[model samples]
Target: MKFQQPLRNWGGSLVILCLLLYLTLGANSLEPLLGPLAPENAPAIYARNSFIDLVGWHLLLVLIAISAAAVIAILAALFVSRPVGADFLPLARSLANLGQTLPPVAVLALAVPAVGFGSWPTLIALFLYGLLPIFENTLAGLGSVPTTVKDAARGLGMSPLQRFWQVELPLALPLIITGIRLSVIISIGTATIGSTVAAKGLGEVIIAGILTDNLAFVLHGGLIVALMAMLLDGLFVKLERRFATV
Candidate 1:
């Protein structure tokens, strides 16, 4: 469903309100991090710049993880969506559960020993942690497709590939978006852990804040990350609704 203009505007307004809150409350409290912005410095601008730079720095790796997960999810969904593919359901479920059961930090630590620090280990860990929600959702969404729809699509002379693309996928999109939204939000949270390995992100500011007892700084970094995740999730939800309506 195309979100009506009023609803879309309302979403935008809510985001603006959040930013304002972050600026007014979160920023003021953040004086601990920056030791009060200098006369020449603008705290809000500085925070915004830091958040943007942090995202820019890791954008490529995050994209890699997201792309990999999407590909795997698509394949898994297609496979499990078919009647003959029932045998793999147990394995898919196990994999999804196992991915989450393994602690990402522990995985990161183990990976560090082999891969050695920086972004690689962190990326791997985050990627693994992210697989479950997306993979499971993909499988579940596809499985939930009405059998009648599939039969009709097949009867209409649509090839397996064509039916999958046209029928199964469109019906499954909302669930897929929900999975992706969860993965993206989880990735945002996990990315902060990357700072421990000296990979740059908002986590660096947070870690610094913790080490220095700069409440303002830590809160500033954290608040920014939270806001970013919420914004992305909100956008994805809109997309989800639109696709579901189609």
Candidate 2:
């Protein structure tokens, strides 16, 4: 059974890795066949960067944006979940929901006035849009920890801080990770719109395709982003399963 489980995990990992590789290389390999489809007078299919450059930099920006959102959301969730901040939970929830309530494009448009375009405004928009899920899940996970478990920890002479670190946080981790995973996937899709704000991401290709009426560019960009989201979500699923076993 143990051997079978490890083998299954290895197989899954290998499959995902191959899929990622195909997503990364397949479009470029097929470009020759697909390139001819573009209108004879169409502008260049995509911006000046090579495929690797486009995907690599776009991914980096996405990671940066999501990482920032995770940090901010987790910290804020932790704060509001505490007893001292309990009264402010409703307000926090509202603020978190506000991100999703506004369209990413509108967020970008509103932000550009202050941040003035490029990746910064896009980052801000993604960060805001990602907050609600993480915040809600964090709250749910932390709140779901049993009262009896907390009481037992207290009876065992564990300090509140110790109990939180060793017990509550560990128990809540899987759900928190789930929230992070969802936020990341959603961010990956939405980040494409960043191109409209002058940020470099896969969305640039999609937008360019729209401008030139080139479907190839749109397909390539969309495929890359979709594959990236699937890969990350798969990793997070493994992580969640591991946490579940614990």
Candidate 3:
């Protein structure tokens, strides 16, 4: 396990280093191939910001949105998985389903009028779009805990709260983390669209490219986002394995 940990860390680190090298040194070389660069035809490479700024802010927004969504999902799952709150599961599921079914663009469109554009609207959209998977996975994980194990905890004089905190949560953690991973990766891709609402993100680059027919901008943005998603997914896989082996 110790050996495996270093291997995983190295793998993730290598991917990140490669991505950074590309963003810093390789992106410029690909510009000619990605699109025409005439002054009249091309969009300014990044429009308003540097590549590092774009990637940094995009990731920051995504991190904030996904963290919020994960917290909400976990709390909701904890509440609804309990016997006292079991009856509300159907309602909770319905709401989470609704969040998924409504297109994120539509959510953004609706949110902008109320939230007045920018990161807030984007955050709202991502949070809503990310809820279902995490909620469902948390519910499944918590519900999957063996009854006998629970009974054993009771036999040992553990309180309900103690059992849940010490035993059930640890067992359920891997699945819950998986849910978070899914939600985060989904959010990473979806968040690129946030640029349309005047929120700062890689999506701005892609959208600018589309409007101006500059494929270089689009490719750069997509590459950054794809690398980010892969990096995060890899990290989460490591985290899930760590929790599972515990």
Least well predicted 10-residue stretch by lDDT in candidate 2: 1-10
lDDT (Cα, tens digit) per residue for candidate 2, span 1-246: 134444236466677667667656665566675577677765434546666777786778768877887788778888898888889998988776775677767876787898997988888877777777888788888889999999999999999889989999899899989998988887787678888888877888888888878877777777777767777777877788889789
Per-residue accuracy of model 1 over 1-246 as CA lDDT, tens digit each: 444644234567487557845554555454554555322343322353355567566555566777787777777767765778789878878878777777667777776887887888778876776777888888888878889999999999999889988998888888988898888877777778778987667788778767756565576677777666666666777788788878
- The C-alpha stretches of model 1 lying farther than 4 A from their native spots are 1-51, 58-60, 83-86
| Per-residue error (Å), model 2, residue 110 | 1.8
Winner by lDDT: 3
Residue pairs in candidate 3 whose N, alpha carbon or C atoms collide under 3 angstroms? none
| Tens-digit lDDT string for candidate 3 (94-198) | 887776777767877888998897899888888887878899889888888999999999999999999999989999999999998988887887778878889
Report the Cα lDDT for candidate 1: 0.72
Q: Over 4 Å off in model 3, which ranges?
A: 1-13, 24-44
- 2 or 3, greater by lDDT: 3
Q: How high is the CA lDDT of each candidate model?
A: 0.72, 0.77, 0.81
| Count of backbone clashes, every candidate in sequence | 3, 0, 0
The predictions' CA RMSDs to the true structure, in order, are 5.1, 3.8, 3.6
For model 3, what is the alpha-carbon lDDT of residue 36?
61
Assess every candidate by TM-score: 0.80, 0.87, 0.86
